[model samples]
Each structure stands twice: as C-alpha cells, then as structure tokens.
Target: MFLNRKVELSLLENLHAEGKPKLILLYGKRRVGKTELLNEFARRHRALYLVARQEAYEGQLKKMSSEIAEFFDDDVLRHSPFQNYDALFIYLAQKETPVLFDEFPYLVEANRDLPSILQEYWDRYFSKKKTFLVLCGSSIAMMESLLGYKSPLYGRRTEQILLEPLKFREACEFFPQLEQEDKVLAYAVLGGTPAYLLEFDYGKPLLENIRDRILQKNTFLYQDTMFVLQQELTEPRVYYSIINSIAKGNTRLGEIMNDTGLEKSKITKYLSVLKDLHIIERRVPVTEKSPESSKKGIYLLKDNYFKFWFRFVFENAEYIEQGRQEKLIGDKISPVLNNFAGFAYEEIVLEYLKSSPGFPDYIFGRWWDKEEEIDVVGLDSSQNRIIFGEVKWKALTEKEARQTLNQLVEKSVEVKWGENLKSGEIQEGPEKKYMLVGKKVGGKKRLLGDGYLVLELDDLVEN
Candidate 1:
C-alpha cells in the first residue's frame, strides 16, 4: 500500500535529523494519502499523533484536554489551570515530542482565531520549547491561506509539504500481475489517488472492479465526486454544472458558460475554484510564451476519476437510477471510454518520460495549429535538446509505426524553437533528438538514426 512515498519519508527523516522540533504544514486534496503518510511517519519516529476533531471550540478543547491528559499521564487537566490556548501550549511546550494537528482546517473552522492563538504560543513558547508541531489538512484553500504571508501562522511553519498523487508507474507497483496496458487503463480511470487504487481487487478483473466498486449503486466512490464538491462549496449546483459541462467536452470558456447556463464572469470564479481543487485544468498551445496571458486557451477536467464520473455517472443519473445502468454505459460511456483510453495512453507516455533516464529540464506538451499533435515533448533547455514523442493506442505493425513516426517528425517542425535559437546554433546543443512512444513500435532503431529512440509499453516499463 505504501508504494511511492520514499521521497516523502526521506523528507520527514531529514527534518527529524535536524534535531529541531520543526513546525510543518502538510496539505493536499482528500484521499491523496496525507493522513496515511502522516501516520506512517509518526509510527516510524514514535511521534505523538493527535487528530483534531472538527467540532465546536469547547468540544475540541475537551477532547484535546483528554488526549493531553492521557499523553502526559496527568490528572490535573480535568481541573487544569490552562485558561486559553496559550496556557494549553505552555503545558505542551514542556515536552520534546511531535504534535500533529490532523485536519487542522477543521479545528480552524471550529475556532477561526486558532491560527492567531497558535502563532502567539509558537513565537512565545513552542519555538523555544523545540516541540515539533505538524498541521495537516485536506482543504487546499485553508492550507494555502494558513501559510500565506497575510495569515497569523504565516512565518511560523518551518516546512510545508504539498503531497500530490502517486505517479502512473508508482501505482503499477500495486498490481504486479497486471499488464502495462491494463495499468495504464487503471491509471486513466482511478488516477494516482492512493485510496482509489487500493480499493481495486487485484484478484478480480479490472473492468469488473470498475463496474462493481466504482459504478455500483451506493458504492463509496460512486458519488465521491459530488461529496467532495458539496463539502467544499456552498453553491454546489453551479460548480457541478460547470464541472459537468467541462466533463462533457465544452472546453472553450464561452462554451462552458453557455452549457452551464452561468454568466461568463461568474464562470471565471467557478473555474478558479475547480482549478484550485486540481479537478479541472486550463491549457493553451505550447508555442505560447505566456500561457496565462493568452486568451485562446481551453479548459478540461484534469482528474481522471472525476472526468469519468461526471461524463458517465452524473450526466446519465436518470438512466442509471431507472435500472438501465448497463445499457446506458454501453450506449454512451463505452464510446467515450474508448476515446478516453487513447488519450490516457498518451499521458502514460509523458508520465514514463518524467521519471526516465536523461531526465529533461522542461517537458512541453505539443499541440499544433491543426488536429495534428504530438503526445509528449521532452526539452532539455540546459542542453538545447528536444525529444519529440508519438503515442498511439491501436495495434501497430512495423509499417504502421513507421508512418506514425514520420508524422511525429513532421509535427515536431511546427514548434519554432528553431527560430528562437541562433541562426546556426541550437539552444544548448547542435542537434535535437526524437523519441517515439506508442502502443506499437517496431524497427525504429533501424529506420531512424541513433538520435531516435522508439519506445513501446514494455520499453517504457523497462526504462
């Protein structure tokens, strides 16, 4: 279950090795293994783990008093002299142990001024006391604001770790028997979220797991997307409409607003919220120097599970509830799923290169003025080298792969990185490299020269 947290574990070890009880803020989206990682680290280091309850101020105080009393073997907290948070901190400051505020955002919700109170205690007491305090949360907004310059606990945090999901290859380690293609399919559907990946029954077929565990009525993840949205926003319906619109392929800003029946101005805020949650993303052409400044961009659902759920489940809830789930899936979802698989195959290529040998400094996603687009572009600006990649989801004979490679080369020229360089010189080198990645590739080594590397699924697995 702990597949790809080596880097995170190392960071924790380094912090503890510094011999200072550091204040750390660990934050990420729900089900991203934040609490799991936290508990794992705590168990290894024998640190005290205190999960703060999302209750009223008095309730939290009572719960904390009980835990603290138990932790320190004190009977006095029942009638303790701790007047406020300052006194509570003064008491805990006596120990040199790690104090974790799990779901710290919930505690803040209970008492808005908790950050200020913590800041007071941290500066006046805990900093000198050398108590390692970790504040962790799933609420992205709360975590960002707490560490921002304007917040009371701004400078008090010695470290902050924003945990992202496990990568594609990392997730594959969980199901060793699954083929690379099936692993890619799983990645596309479940994404790298640990909770979702762990739910898969390795003994069962992947599609069966998808149908039974993911799409079954009353399943935990069946309505997970809605729950996550409703928890974060008061006006969930508008956001749902926006998400559904984007999920349904309304990528253009105007198109999304039109589909959602929301005003364009309001769409911006909704888009921002979704972007902040890491659900949807806005993308522009790679050639654009300033992507944010460019007006001609498209928005898409970024999370695979959310994308899949909204596209199939949420959109056709009526059909599903009417005992036509299988029929609806066959008629509507399967076609999209096929196309989704092809797109996901391309992502697998990029994910492979991200952790491959000759790690590039910059990886630009290539999109042409026309329908022709390259799957992955690995550019080493430091070396002035570009690696163009082509991905396909269909079976490829030697003849078919050669044609795809040729097309990739043709599209690579559309990116005018050549013009940006000197007349006779490349950015960091005198030559560029081409990489072909697809479902099927053969005789690439013979057809292309030494500069080209043909990579198939097995090749990527090895790499």
Candidate 2:
C-alpha cells in the first residue's frame, strides 16, 4: 500500500544527510501512517526506536532504560528508570545516533512536566550534541500546544513535519489498473487515508471492494470513526451528533447547533477539534481577507468516506448491517453519487486551480449569495486579474462547453475582481482567464477568446 510520499520522504532524508544535530517532530491524525513512515526511516538508519507505552510514567521510563542498556552496551542503565531523564540525556549526548519516541504524547500525558524537562535537557545538554531526536504523535492539539508559543518546547524544535493523506495523483499508484476516473472516484471515497486505501483489493472491482472491505459485517473500518472519537475525547456522542449534522449539510453554525441539540458556544470547541483532526474544514468565501471578517463560514466533513457514510449509510445503519448495502446503494446512494461527485469534482478543480500556473496571488472562492457560484476564482491584487472556471464530470461536447463558457462571460460581470474594472470593461481589467476541467477536454472554442486552459483526467494519470 505504499504509494508516493515523495515530499515527506525527501525532507526526512535530506535532514539526515545534513549531518547535523536535528530534532524532528512528526504529528498528524491517527492511522494516517506516522508510525509506519518513522519505522521505515528508522530501519534505513539502523536507529534505536522506543515507543512510550500506556503505563505509569516510571514503568515506561524503566522500559526505555532497558532498551538504552541493550542499545549502548551499558548493563547498569537497565536496573532503574533514568532519574528525571537528565541521566538518559547525558548518555544520549555522547552518541551520534537517531533516537525516536513514538506516541510521545503518552509520555507527556503521563507526566506533564516532561516537555519542561526535555527543554532543560535540550538547552543544557542535547542542543550541542549530534543526535537526531524525533517525537511523533497523533494528537494534534497536544503536539501543537507543546511545540507552540508559551509551551515548554517552544523554540527548541529544529523541524516539524505535519503529514497529510495521499494526493489524488499518488492514489493512482495503488491500483494501476484503475482508470483515471476511477482514481478520482477512489479519492472521493477514501480521501487519501493510507489505512483506508490499504483495504482495497487491486485484483477486484471498486464496487466489490467497497461491499466486502468497507460495508461487510466484520470490516475493520465499520466502527473506525467511533474508535477514533473514543480514543481522542470523552464525549463521543455529542461530537458524533455534530459531525453527523455537518455531514448531512447542516453547515451553518446555528443550523449545526440546532440539529445536534448543542449550544452555539459549545459548537466552536467541538468544531475546532474536528478541524485539527483534519476530518472537517470550515471555509468562508474568498472575498473576505480573513475568516474573522466573513460571516459566511461553512463547515464541511472533509473526509469523503465519512461524508458518504453519514449522508446515506449511517442513517440506514440497521438495513446496512442486515446486508442491504447493494439495495441501499441502488435506492438511496446512486442518485446522490452524481451530486456528491459533482461537489467533489468542484473541490478537485479548485484545488488544482490553486496549484496551477498562471494563477493570481489573491485567489479566493466565489459565491454570489445565490445559486451562481464559480468553482474557482483567481484574483490578482497587483494587476486586477480575474479568472473564472467550471468543473464538469459529465461528457461535455465542444458546443455544450462553449455555451457554458458563454454563461461564464455573463457571470463574470457580477464578480468584483477589483475597483479598477468598470461595468462593461471588466474584461479590460486584465487578460481574461477561463478554464474547463473534466474527464475529456473540449476544443479551443470553449476558451471564449480568453487565455485557454483545459485539464483532462487522462493527462493527469500519465503524469
């Protein structure tokens, strides 16, 4: 299931090759494969790895003491826990080795003063040494708080790595036989989680994989979200209700609170946790310079599988558990698939547009406070530039696409790219930018005399 982790792999490798004393912090969501990556890295380096267990502070320290004894050929260090970690610090200072602490937050939780202690050791002992100390965790709140300003470890960390899910392009490596359209569909369903992607059977059809590996009775991921919730927080049901509400399109703050029977004030904390977990994202239209200035903040479950499950399957869990997945997919989910795919297609297009060349610096999302919403908008603050784009999953012929382009020309006047453009002269503001993204590209006529850009999934898969 290992696909492309090019960016992360390269960074870690370069850090090691720098031949300096570096402290690396790796943090991300649970089951996003932080440990797996660390293990792979450690194996390559022949490093000493110690995973802090869920035991008392003294017991865990004693376990580490034993490992250090075995690693360094010092039998005396095994009998007792390194008193206050200063002794262990002194031992590690003499060696130029890679030392990793996985699930480090457990050690921190077992002893709140651990970060302060590490800070003292780093400044007094380890900072001048040549060892690479990597602290890894899944709790974003804990990790960020510890390394953030005002925390004990602030300014002491040399580097931080926040691992994300596999991208759409990387997911293609998992199922080579799967077509580009199917890769996009898989990305929508799996949302790039390596754990979820590993469950797929490359030899079988996508729907068959979904039926057996995802919806079956004893599937690992059937209660996956529940386990994640229980491990991370105490009040799982309330958070579940709010997440389910958002998944069902109850996006507004008031709407989510009402649907979940939670107070408005409490909703913020819950939503913040979800955002930190990278399961959901809150977005305001791009017109506003910052989130605070915008009143249009909308929350969405960013995890595609969770969104799909909450939207259709969770509502009919009884039937799903009774082996009605096929019927449910036909009766309830199929119609919504196109609609859902349409939204996902829009997201994919927006994401690509952001990273694509020729985009402006002040790129913002567009919504007209009505049904007219542009999928992506690139705004050039320096040059008063406006680019409009549309993403279509359907097979659009050149004529149909040209009509859509003409429609965009009409909609272009409504968007305020800046004050420089007069009513009839918005096109004169800057070179007009228009894009059409889909499974297949229509001819140049769809460009509407603007700088043309066409993106087809076929081209994406080859790269």
Candidate 3:
C-alpha cells in the first residue's frame, strides 16, 4: 500500500518541475518504500522507468538497450544494442522525458567504472541536453559514496534524497482501526518498516498477528532481518555480535569490545560503517557543549525493527526451529512486551516534539549527569528556552503527574544551559518549561492549566 509518501512524491515533483538538466539521486535501505514511491511519482508523468539486474556489463547494457528500445519502439537499436555508456546516454539525452533507474547500484556493481562513465556523459552530452535522469539504489554506503567529495558524480547531482523509514506517527497509518494502545504495540514490534508492516494482518489480534506473521517459518518477516543484513554486510555474523552486544545494554565502545571480544580500534571502525548503513547511531547528551568531542556518546540501534528483532527473534531462534512458538511467546515476549513498548513510547514522544514543541529552533534529546535522568530535553537557542520532560508508557493520575513534574523541576536546576545565565551575565534567567507525556494522563486539562505542556496518546496520534 502507498501510504505517507506524499511528501517524498512532492519532492520528486518539485525537482522535476525545475525543467532543466536534472540528475536526481534517490537512495535508502531496503523495504523503505523507495520503489513504491518512485512508481507512484512515475504515474503522474510519462517517465521511462528501468530496474537494473546483477549480470555481466555487456548484459546490463543490452538489457537497458532493450528497455529503451521498447520505450521508443526503435527497430534499428532493437536489432543492435548500444556498444557503450555513451550510446545509451546519448539516446536518452535526445528527449526531455523523466527517467528513473531503480536499483542503479546493480548496474554499477556489474560495471565498476559506471560512475566515471556516467559523469563523463553527463558533463558532455546529457547536461547540454535537457536529459532528466535518476539513479536509485538500496546500497546506503555505495550510494552515499557517490556524493562524497572524491567521487566522480559528486557535484553533478542537482538533487539527492536519502529516504528513511516512516516515523512512529506515519507508521500508525497502516493500522487505522487499532486502539491507541494496540497501535503503539504494533508500531513497537514492527517499527516503521513499510514492508514489515504489510506482513501483519490487521484484523487479527496483535499476538496472533505476531505469531502468524513473524513466528512462522514460512513467513516473509521470519528471516527478513537476517536477510537484510546478509545483503548489506560481507561479514554479517561479526556485525550481528556487535548488534547483540548493544541490545544487551552495551552502550559504551569498551563494553561492546569486551562483550564481542573484538579489539577497540576494529570495533570503532565497524561501528562507523554501521552508522553509515543506518543500522546504529551514536548519541550524546543534548546538553553537551561540544557533542562530537563529548567523550560521553552512546550507541543505539537507529531502527526499531532491528531492536525488536534482536531482542526477541534473534535470541529465541531455537523456539521457531523446534516449533515452540507458544512457549516462546508465553515465556519470552509476553512477559517483557510492555517493557519493550516503553522505549517505543519514548521514540514517539521524541518524534512528536520535533514539530509540536513550539520551539522556533531547538535540539531534542534525553539527558543525564550521574544520578538524575530526564526522559526528554529540548533546548531552544533562538529564545533561550529550555524544556525538561518526563515520559511514561503507563497511565498516570493528576497527583502522580504533579509529583513527576515537581521532580523534573528539581532536576531542571541541575541542567546548565546558556553561558550567560549561569554567570549572571543576564539578570533574568532563561525560560524553563516542564512537559510530560504518557499513554494516558488523567486531568490533562488541569495539567495544561497548571502551565505545563502535557500530551497523551490520543493527542499524539490525532496530530
């Protein structure tokens, strides 16, 4: 199903609207709906779309020649394929029609010098003509390299889009009728993956859906996480160890090294590659002065599906192998499902704060010093306003929420922001705001009347 892609489709439309020699690069991870979004955009225009295959370079050229021939019904080119990159690009440069090449990296893999060749043709022929060309790929690392300073196609691309998985709010579109709590649980398990969400049967209960869709050996999602890793990594097992180590609460580099028994330098290098692949992320406290050099960074899996899969499926593979799905669900998943949903709840709150925090310009993050930890911290540099928040996946009464807010007020004093405020350079201190989010917060109106930002599940989903 095509859902929550109008923004991306509009972006492609805007680029196409430029009406010049447009070379667009659209790349992201697998099953992120890149192909579907492109196909949707193609429907609006008579774009010549081509998907590359993994074969010999000659075969790649001939296959595209056939596709182009079919597009124009050229009998001569149909009889004889284009000899080189120039001929294919020259032929395409003849028209101003938009063209999309899905999985463009496959062609590059078969032809190692494809980037330089395309660069030469683009500068000489295609750029001079009104040739609209798009190169799409699922290889995050390789596609990103094309934009690097040293790469051949670095400056040639007029537009580039790094598509990502749907956010918590967008992902809920797949389950329209699910209750707020159920929707949150579904999102917690499936994350924001379009392909993975499609595997679930919305009519069934969440547990049943998880059983029939994910636990079954013959299902698409059962082995999908492993397959994606295999396709991306040359050494999936080594990376798997690191991923598992992090899932087990090894947030520090030294902790991961000790757990995986890998050397420090090697782990750091692999972690860098993992970040580039969008599999993991490095986070520092939002209040840190120099974030990159803070020396307090922690690693987190960027994708929720990866986190869920590793926490449950990867750990209990034997349950599926031995046909003990019931036991696994009863003993493993059901027991800790709510606990798992807490993190997803935090994710939803963070994403929601991005647009609704009323900050003109701000950075959002979780904060901790030694003992005190804040679930949500937003700093608005433009107004010198700071918001300290506490989020919970559980329901809270007004009294409990007041206590939480009071505790947050105590911790707010600990957060040192804005050099001028701490040194008494400005008599009036920076504005401090208290916020709270939960699955259900009783007396939300009263809490809002108390001059605090409060949101519950319904408020979050509707927005």
Best by lDDT: 3
Write the number of the candidate with greater TM-score, choosing between 1 and 2: 1
Model 3 lDDT, residue 450, Cα: 79
TM-score ranking of the models: 3, 1, 2
- Estimate, for each residue in 1-463, the C-alpha lDDT of model 3 and write its tens digit: 6889778998888877777788889998999999998888877888888899888889988998998888888999999999998788777777777889999989889888889989998998888866778899999888998899998999999889999899878888899889999999999999888999898889899889888888888888888888889888998899999998887678889889999999998898899989989999998888888988978788999888788788888888999999999899999999999998998899888888887746547789998776677899998877877888999999999889999899888877777567723313446777778999988888899989979999899988996
TM-score of each: 0.92, 0.91, 0.96
lDDT of 2 at 400: 80
lDDT of 2 by residue, 1-463 (tens): 3457778877888888887778889998877878888888788897888898888988887888988888877867766558767777777877888989999999988988889888988888778867689999988778888777998889989999999876666766776787667777777777767888788786786667666777765787676867776777778888888888988889889899888888877998989888877778988766555667667788988777788767765677876768898887777766677677777767776766566554537475655434567676666667755677777887677878778777877776666435534324654567667767777766754464556667776655563
Candidate 1, lDDT over the whole model:
0.77
Clashes of each: 1, 0, 0
Question: Against the unseen true structure, what C-alpha lDDT does each candidate score?
Answer: 0.77, 0.76, 0.87
- Comparison by lDDT, 2 against 3, better one: 3
Candidate 3 residue spans exceeding 4 A from truth: 420-428
Clashing pairs in 3: none
